[model samples]
Target: MGRSRGGYSTKIHVSVDGLGNPLELRITGGEKSDITQGEELIEGWQRKDTKVIGDKGYDADKLIEKIGEAQAVIPPKRNRKTQRHYDKHLYKERHLIECFFHKLKQYRHLFSRFDKLARNFLSFLYLVSALFWLK
Candidate 1:
């Protein structure tokens, strides 16, 4: 959890498959940048034909290189000196991940952060993810 103006908050980082099923999930303090956790979320994802779609926050030289053979559909940030092009059609698929979040938030306890311990929260997250797979 991270202390902020509103109070303590946690950030949930998730990686979803092409079908919008979650592949991995990580929880970090609200203050942590998406880039800091991007690498871990993509760790061991080396399928050459796979496309890694992400928002501009995941745009970084190191992370891109880590993606290696996999196609990266991340749009370059506006401030970058050389803007890189990405597949707009594929990037549209990113909404699937957003939809997953919407579904997750429908669970009141998860949305309200009822669990004080991060471990407990993470455990519940895993359970919810499993339930999603079951459905």
Candidate 2:
């Protein structure tokens, strides 16, 4: 369980294409570090021209080195001494993925973890995702 000032929550990590279509998803306790699943999210989906874009939470040396080998647009954390360069223009496109999350939350059942079991929650998530794709 992950708890913060807001109380217990979970983090839904996602990988999306340039078009804003979700390619993959993973759920973890909110306390979990985003970098832990960063590499796995791009595993087999990586391509030569693929550029992985992420927020400051995904900033890490190993993840940067791993995805940077292909093309990474991840911004360095503000606290980093050696700041990394990223294309602000490309990073702006990250809003597409954020919008997708907002859309998913539109479904009342998904707005909260009504289903206690992870399997049940994930199943509903897949169903909701399919609906999004159909739209």
Candidate 3:
């Protein structure tokens, strides 16, 4: 989602790997924090073999520490009170996730939240991802 007169718009909670491929997508209330949705987005098998990269917004101590075998490559937020170590070079590669979102939203079905149910919306997003692979 993009910025608007109403303030920052909707946040698409996309979970991507170190290479920036979308593994999961979740729609939340526009005001939600990226870190708040991180765990739910990265749970189970998909997270078993990956190094997750995200910006400072996902700098929660809990999430940074607990992603199963996957490493949370998120840097510490500016105001964080502790000395946290993160891989800067790895974080740079995170732009792939951004590009994925940009491409994902190009599909008309995913540009807006038209479905009333979360499952339906998720299915549309998956369809959008599938269509991208078809190109």
lDDT of 1 by residue, 23-110 (tens): 9999988987889999999998868998898899899999999999999999999999988889999899999899999989989989
- Using all chains and alpha carbons, the TM-scores for the candidates as numbered come to 0.95, 0.90, 0.76
Q: Report the Cα RMSD per candidate.
A: 1.0, 1.8, 3.8
Higher-scoring candidate on TM-score, 1 or 2? 1
Over 15-134, each residue of candidate 2 has an lDDT whose tens digit, in order, gives 987777788988887888999999889787556688888999899988877774577888999999999888999898899889989888898887777776667777888888888777
Model number with the top lDDT: 1
Q: Which ten residues in a row have the lowest lDDT in candidate 1?
A: 1-10
Q: Model 1 off-target regions past 4 Å?
A: none
Report every candidate's CA lDDT: 0.91, 0.82, 0.72
List the lowest-lDDT window of 10 residues for candidate 3: 1-10
Clashing pairs in 3: none
Clashes within 3 Å, all models in order: 0, 0, 0
User: Model 3, range 1-135, lDDT digits (tens) per residue?
Assistant: 334567545677887654556677777656667778887876773355577777887788788667757766788878878968988887888888878988876776667666656677678888877666666
